[model samples]
Target: MTIDSPSLAPAPPAPPGDTAVHPTPARTPSAAPERLSTRAKLVLFVLCAAQFMIALDFSILNVALPVLGKDLGMGQADLQWAVTAFALPSGGFLLLFGRIADLYGRRKLFLTGLGVFAVASVLAALAWDPASFLAGRALQGLGAAIIVPTGMSLLTTTFPEGPQRERALGISGTLLSLGFTIGMVLGGAMTDTVGWRSTMGLLAVAGALVLLAAPKLLSESRHPQRPRIDVPGAITVTGALLSLIYGLSTAAQQGFGSLDVIVTLVAGVLLLAAFIAVESRSAQPLVSLKMLRRRSVAWGNLGGIATFSMMSTVVFLLTLYLQEVLKLSALQTGLIFGVQGALSAVAGVLAPKVIGRFGARNTLVGALLLQAVFTASLLGLGVASGAWLALVGVSVASVGHLGAIISYGVIATSGLPDDEQGLATGLVTSSQQVGITIGIPLLSALASAHVAVLRDGGDGFAASTLGGIKLGLGVDAAVVAVVAVLVAFGLSRRADGGVAVGGRTGGV
Candidate 1:
């Protein structure tokens, strides 16, 4: 084990039976002292920058969608496509590309993703019509799908597990959240001042800069046993995710009553079943069912999806409340999220320490509970004047949100070996992307359905909207609360007093 800085030193070897599900690369100690070089630090910067750009694109177009639709002479369904196109490929292809990176080369995949993202951004910026713009967005989503899992695998492979990996993930998670908030602010400001195209231009520049630096800084890493592609598993899973995301995204805009939504959803479920069966029997499965059976991977992903979904849904609801109910300007709503972003930064910085002290399982459950409490507190909000409540609830809940984000990553990836790092991080990023994609649609649909009922009962528009928002918040809180309990039980202490998750004295 190479001891770099104190922070970079790898943890002591796990006891027998605690290694990994797959064969791990041997971790032999180096004779000489090893320090994380300036080049390695620069590499981390580039990786994080790429992740920041990915997160930025997720939220940046949201505020500018109306402007974009008007400029392109597009209607409501077309606008929905703008968002859905990006989400479809991004959420669908994560697991496939992640396994590919491990089989081929992470550095090669990372560079390819950055190039694709930069070019896609330029294409979107220069789009002349809805067809061109949707094409660009869909390509950008593919780029994002490749970038996130590859970059994360690179990060994990570079930094040995322990304080070093935790710290690096903290910085990356911080920038990720900050990027989303900053994009919201920048999207509104740039759209009003310059043009909506500038948002795409900004991503283009970021991607280009990161791409330029990454070639030199990144080292090639891949699994030792390069297995054949799991073609059947890949096709089934990818098709399943695309269908599911489309069904859910469509249901958010239109109700679930649509034939397309119903058909696609059923298709998605059927494909998912097929994928599971394929993976179970494949010689080299795209995803290992045994790995998924790991306590850490299973519960950690559960917490991750829950936290991400609920927090994003809360933000979306508040965005509606701010704009439609209180009639705040987009810029004003962005600024409010800006404050939450700032608080999130603080939380991110502190997350590693919180995990270190409380253990990842405890920290995850606690964070979810904190998030639930603060989210439920938003019930105090009214249609007339509850701007402060929105600001306060979101800001406070964001701390737990960030904490959960970091802790879940730590838990999910902690016990995994180098060969499987890509697959493990794939699961983590999948949780994130799938969460963000589904959260708003699922909760918003419920809210919309409720609002229709309220309106039918003779409630005013403002009252109906408020009632819907409250219902969403309540469900969000309830979901998080329940998941927190499940995670607590799922990752509970083992008979020997060791953690059941990470296969160590304590998980993470």
Candidate 2:
């Protein structure tokens, strides 16, 4: 039978015996049929809402950082921690949580994650000190770590591969970009008028709504012979990721040579190495090592990491420049950034069509190259370059970045079996988050260092600061270009057929 929703059709049934192995129950017959029904739309709504909530959290707090820093008596470094706290766990625990969803049920994990996220947001709103706020944010991250991947898995499973799925994915991508834009604007408004606490309160309310709607819409996947949760694998991997992210984030502030930084870095490396070894041997590893062996997955993940790193760092630095250097009000800064978000949303909506025409690999390579060009263009403009020019470059870059992201999303999931979809999606999404966490600090530090050097050479703080931002953007552009080149040659070996990497076809 043909599934109506493009998102829900065209996927071959799970390999014969696999269904017996993972016997997810169909949604209640009284509610809606699995094939296609009005009930499925409700399911999609809940999933999209959850995904949007998670996406909003990533960018919403950007506008609140200044206010949060002041209220909690935090300095610059402490403020960075607020963002890092959320990003680190959100990225670090993705793989573990994805595996849990597969072993358990996506609907179960998603609702549970929403509950945790809501509680965490409430705690964040009431926090009286930096430590408490940071803790709350960390918990929020943990919740998001579970919510995002599980939600994606649900979409992948619910929809079949076709126009319906493609359209749904496109809409989902648009919603994500829109959420980021809305978050920035909402965050600024809340921070300026109601206070920073209101921002967290907003997330809490949204999360609660998602929790309420989830039960009605979502169906639990069956797992007749549920695989045992790999506790050791989860622990080692989580620890390793946390340590590595913390170390990388800390390096921005304390320098890589700091004893604490060195210790964390070493510990993270060792733990990660140990985790890989364990996965290679485990009967049911959290992440299939065999998946990583695929060239498509490996290179696609690397490209995702590099692309998101550039995008996140650009957003961070530009926000700072708009506020501190250009002296724009919070509202104005939000408005300016909103333009970029709008362009990205538009690009996301159009991305599927572009991919269909050009093919995924070609579209991805072109988008990345365009992104690099736009990023480099930003380096050529300054305060004297005119506001219109700056805005144009920013919008162009935003469009390209969004296009690249959508392309990657489609390309990465192509040809994967249903069972592996959750884990693979989680890994790729985690790479993006990890890139953001690592990118912000590293790029910020680069800008700061460059500013110091220029100041020492007699340029005033303002001039030096802008100069530093220019240099940092240049570096970001270069990195993106390099990654695009790698994808073009290494990952895009076969155009007509699916991408092949490491002798595997589907994983990429």
Candidate 3:
């Protein structure tokens, strides 16, 4: 499994999924390699811009949902589809495209994805109906699926492992995390001030500028062997992920007990089974099943699933609590998260120091424990108590979430040589996009079920809705808490066996 470094293309940046916190390992920026040339700086800047563009769209549409619904005469059930449509394709297609990027050229794929995203942005901006908008959104997701993996591949290949790459990755990771907050706030402000279309227009403008500059700034790079596309592996994995995400989201609607949910989930599982079979046999597999045996890769992906799924759930549900329940303006909701986002970025900035002092495992354990506490506090949330409690809890909770992100990224990609970095990053990215794809809808469904129960008992719509939200938050907190314990235990076992993980002391 050892990959000889063959002067692959400079790594672009961690794709959107691995972009949980910082791509930089747990090292100080001052420890980074000396004298980054002007061109190196440009490479970093261009890739970061692409990362921000793709990441921004993930949340940009979140705040615009209300306005989009109003403009297109859509309902709550359908409004969620806009988010899912983008997430499913984006998350599902990543491995397929990541492999493709490596085989053909990362630069080519990156540029193409950017152009596709730009065109998709324009399509979304000009959409006059729900179908058109959804179509555009899906295309954008496809573009992101391609762009993120290629971008990250470019990054790892560009800089050799150690301080220089860590610094570069930190920039990439920070920007990736920044997208969610920025999108929520920016989407809200634009939707409120101009229109939902303006939000789409903004992406179009940004994508256009990057699309033009990428070729000039980036040199082409690819895997040295130019491995053949693992078509069966690609098909099966993409199908499994898309089906799984779709099933998870559908379960939120039909309930886990519903026949469709059961059938769809079974199909997803079967597809994944098929994917494992295919990957095990393929010479050039899309995903190396053996990689999962590595402690850092396996456990790190688990941590990623927890951190991303749980944190994103908080944002999605909290936004509902603020706007749908409290009847706050989009701009107000945006401003709150804007502040939270800035705070989260600051937390990310401090990650190296935090990891240095606490060690990676401790950083994650503490962060996740605190996350559990803050998220649990939301269970006590009710509109009657005012927005302050929810705001403060979620805002502070995000800092802990920020730490988990950094630790997970460090864990997932740590100790890997350059050639395998793509596969490692691809897995991390998949975990993230899948987390985002499923978390909101999963909680949304729980919220709906709670509302249904309360309404059946003759509760008011407002009361039932609030009840549902709190219950969902309760569930979210429990999941994160459990993950915290499991990760700590697993990492502890690994550490006892003398494998450093999640910090300078270990593999991470």
TM-score of each: 0.93, 0.88, 0.88
Relative to the unseen true structure, what is the C-alpha lDDT of residue 232 in candidate 1, on a scale of 0 to 100?
99
lDDT of candidate 1 over 1-508, digit per residue (tens) = 1112234443464433332221122343211112356766787798899999999999898889999999999996778898899999999999999999998998899899999999999999999999999999999999999999999999887776655676678889889889888988989899999999999999999999999998877778888889899999999999999999999999988789999999999999999999999999998899999888777788899999999999999999999999999999887899899999999999998987776556677788899999999999999999789999999999999999999998888888865677888999999999999898889999999999999999999999999999999999999999999999998887774533225333222235
Model 3 misplaced regions, further than 4 Å: 1-37, 73-76, 257-260, 494-507
State the local distance difference test value for candidate 2: 0.75
Can you write out model 2's per-residue Cα lDDT over 196-309, one digit (the tens) per residue? 899899999999999998887677872446788888899999999999899888888887778998998899999999999999899988888877755556666777788788
lDDT of each model, Cα atoms only? 0.86, 0.75, 0.77
Alpha-carbon deviation at 358 in model 3, angstroms: 3.8
Question: Which is better, 1 or 2, measured by lDDT?
Answer: 1
Shift in Å, residue 92, candidate 3? 1.0
Deviation in Å, model 1, residue 87 alpha carbon = 0.4
Candidate with top TM-score is: 1
